[model samples]
Target chain A: MARSPATSLLPGITIILAGAAIGAGALTYPLGSVFRPGPGFFPLGLAGLLMATGLGVVIEARGSDAAPPEPFAWGALAGVVLSILAFGLTVEHIGYIPATLLLFAICAVFERFRDWKRLALTAAIISALGTAVFLWGLGLPLAAFGGA
Target chain B: MDLLAGFQTGLATALTWHTLMYCFIGVTIGTFVGVLPGIGALAAISLALPLTYYLDPTDALIMLAGIFYGAQYGGSTASILLNLPGTATAAITCLDGYPMAQQGKAPLAIFVTAINSFVGSSIAIILVMGFAPAIAEFALEFGAPEYFSVMLLGLVAASTLTIGSPFKALSMVVFGLLLGMVGTDVNTGQFRYTFGLFELADGFSIVAVAMGLFGVAEIISNIGQPQSVIRDVGRIRMADMLPTRAEWRQIVRPTLRGAGIGSFVGALPGTGPGIASLMAYATEKRISKTPERFGHGALEGISAPEAANNASVQSAFIPMLSLGIPGDAVVAVLMGAMILHGITPGPNLINSEPQMFWGLIMSFWIGNLMLLVLNIPLIGMWVKLLSLPYNLLYPAILVFVCVGVYSADNNVFDIFVVLGFGVLGTLMRRYGFPATPVLLGFILGPLLEEHFRRAMLLSRGDATVFFTNPISAVFMGLSVLFLASVFLPGLRARLLRQKPGAVAED
Candidate 1:
């Protein structure tokens, strides 16, 4: 029989390293007494708890319907993340309008907005409205199209 | 504080033109947003949080609160009309609601949901008023140990109480706590997690994390799926709304029962309307003479869960406003918003900022009233909103999210953080791990650390102080019990396999 999916074990295991990395990064700080604990004290304890729970998940996974990982939409995932990244990196330099248009084009590719005219119209209208409200109305101090 | 005095002060503050306008805008936006599948109140509040920065603190809070409960009113509409729930809490409504719609009772189901929601909210509003002051007064005596233990209970409950794997939930909470450890340590002045970026000094951006995880992640997951809106938006007959005497008889008992269950569950640390609705539906099913009628077009099914859903949200404010512990992620985000405004919320908030507290109470009433008006007379307008293509709608949501995060501190880096968290949220959902606890852990993480450290310090280096204090010990005991209950079942199943001779229940 084919396995179902990795219910909770994978996510549980991931948090272990995530917690340890956090603790190791802050490991240089003094642990201090319980009376006057230092920066690392709390993180160290949290990391321990994370590791403990990860172990528990491993044990639980053994008795339960352990399954393989399922397929994910890599296309949708990359498109969304890259679009937001492009928006963030360019927004400060290119300003809200052009950056948003670029972000829109990147995202629209995933949605497959087949018509270029429709995509452009949607991007323009959204950017204009966003510029009007946030930039102008809220006075966020951003130029419409380019750098100050 | 006197009840009449509180309401009088609240009314005067909330009735102003600007506050009313903002409240109206929030309610309208909330209802529309709440009706959209895959977008919840958490996403809506995070995306909207930046817009409120320019307004007066009271107006901003009032608007946020409006979005909070207005979604409660509108969420069930989608669940009733389609099998799609607008938020997790509305999922129970789909059981009987979609079935009722199948029987061509869509308008009746919507109307019943509206009425039930109103009844539920009124009871919870009363509970908030009667209980919050008393709770705050009681909380004034809470020391570091009590705070630590209560938060311990909260974190444990968040991990174990939901309908998922407890271990995964616990791990996510720990990760969130670690995330909270980023930025310079307040006590030691040590920079912990910053990889040499100046923006990392303050903390990880809340808006970025929230919008990315909920808003952008939802969009990514929903991409390329056929998002069909209601087909009969303009076609519902007014005659379909009035229920028969048989249906009316089925409604009252369940609604009252649900309201009580909702208010009680709402005050608990980690549970919220979603759990309350589920429990209420289960209770309603158990008590019915014909339990088989539940998944059919039963009137009691529609009435009970809707009543519970609204009441739970209103009363969830109690723990948040009184004890500074949020009942769920949405409330945690609201608590974070309070912190962002330079207002420390706890027992002291009611004592120090009575007007702000009471004004918020009054605005919930005002916001609920506006939702009632918007929901009934203008429901068709909402259905029309539902028909907008998801492809068109989601990209706009992305733009709003981008602007919302950018406008917070006029920084682009927040958007980048959103990108990272969005991917995390997407993966978590795929793996069947709930994302809400991560948020809860993130928001509550700092406070939990502070209280634990303080309790330790106050005890003069004794870690046993958590167990020595009676109140603190009780809460800690509860947390341990919660963990045992979650683990013992899995443990028992494992043990059963080890000793296969043990008799198993049918």
Candidate 2:
């Protein structure tokens, strides 16, 4: 669990900044009296608590044997993120089937065994099953080929 | 309602063809995911949430609860056969179960776990049937102050009791609370943190957030990791599965003790089956005269914790049903499902929805019996499922996640919400923040705040209203004690230092 001091402190700083952002946004709302709390009351309290915990994290990190964080799996992250994004951006526009195939195409980048023919077959099967189950069977108002 | 009447209603509700069919579907899906390594009960429940939009609320709840306890049964199959736990709660089973499997006693180990799981769940179900209504009756006297204090205790216990840096978990809880504040305020008609988007008015979709955190994030982490190879499970005759008289005698006492521990722990406000199983395992080890025999295939090792985990999963429903408070993240998602179905799960729920409550309880008995059949006679089928390639499985899961998120509101924006949180969840995983606490805090935040504000309004802004109420005061004191348990080294060492890194989300 050993790590350099800077790496150990990174999480604490990140939390603090997040807390600050929450607090700043909360400040825009009216702070009513405790007798009649307003919209911002709970969020402001949460933000303060968040920042305090962040400080506690910092202190604890310094006192304990902190380990460096694991490196990000950029390939996996990108593949998943891009695939979901493609689906989200085009689902309503292009509809479920095309959007789903696009999702599969984007996700294929992270696969270790990418036989195109097999992949295409699997994707088609998935699309058909998804269409049959979610669209036709459940009667969800999704278009199979185009925008509903 | 009288006991006989409740049973009659439950039997009538559960025996209907559609209800029985959904129960079957739920347990089947539960076993499938539980037999798999990466996908867990939480992720599976979230995926099924959108699909259940059209079902009756009672049926939906029945199916989802089946997935939960069904996963417990499925998890042990992997632990015993492949030495790979199907779920986190089954991790303890690997200690003795794998050793027994290695010794060609796999059939015996599998039999013991399946039977013990049934025993544990049956006991817990009985407890739920007896206690839930009584607890709800007591909770009917609670006001806003009591609700706030108890919820505060839940959030605190969730953060502090989990295995990790308490401060990091606390940060995630508060972060979740902040996320929960992103919609319109009910007290005033003002939009909060909406940034001019109308979709944000109702709040970030709970399904989207849950999927992103548990589902998408889990897939991202599991992807690119080397998949474990499944070994061939040799032929097993039915005769091998039957326990000898001595083995049966050895298991009975441990199973009973485990059920007791699991029911107690699972009924608590912030604990879950993972903790219950670990505590049960430690207790077994401490009391055994031959502790040295434990890891090498002791029947007690496999029996107690399997029973404990299953028992805990069933008993965890007590707090959720009685107080509308979830003890863990999965139950929190289940609570979210109840809310989505237009049925709030609180003190008035059992009285208001007796059919739903009693029927769900009765279904547990039916579900457990079904699982005993599925796990024992059909064990070979699930073992073959273990051989499915992760490359194929994850892509399909990704598709379900996308469709599921979109289907929640027919909004593309929710998918984006899932994506953003997916990245955030990945980063949190890398940084060692526990994700389960976030979900718990997110679900409880709005209710906690509502109760806090209401209590204050009634008390004329008097902050001490929490302490003035006896029920609220007890919970507040427990919250303080939980905090102190983490900060005080002596208490922390005594209470939580039991098998560190063992307790985790189911």
Kept native contacts, as fractions per model, are 0.83, 0.85
Q: What would the TM-scores of all predictions be?
A: 0.94, 0.98
Model 2 regions more than 4 Å off: none
Per-residue alpha-carbon lDDT of model 1 for B1-506, expressed as tens digits? 78999999889988999889988888877787788876778889998898877788888888888887888777888888877777767878988999988888888998889889989988999999999999889889999999999888888886776665778788888878888888888877888778888888878878888787777888888784665646664456668787788878879999999999999988886677877887788889888999998899888998998899789999989988998888787788888888888887899998788888988888888888888767877777777777777766676788788888888888878888888899888887776667778888888888888888888888898988889899889999999888887758866354223222211000
Docking class of 2: high
Clashing pairs for predicted structure model 2, backbone only: none
Worst ten-residue run, lDDT, model 1 chain B? B497-506
RMSD in angstroms, all models? Answer: 4.3, 1.4
lDDT score of residue A12 within candidate 1 = 57
Candidate 2 C-alpha lDDT tens digits along B231-338: 988976689999999999999999999999988888876677888888899999999999999999999998999899899899999989999989898999999999
Superposed model 1: Cα runs more than 4 Å off: A1-9, A66-70, B237-240, B244-246, B490-506
Candidate 2 chain A: 10-residue stretch with minimal lDDT: A64-73
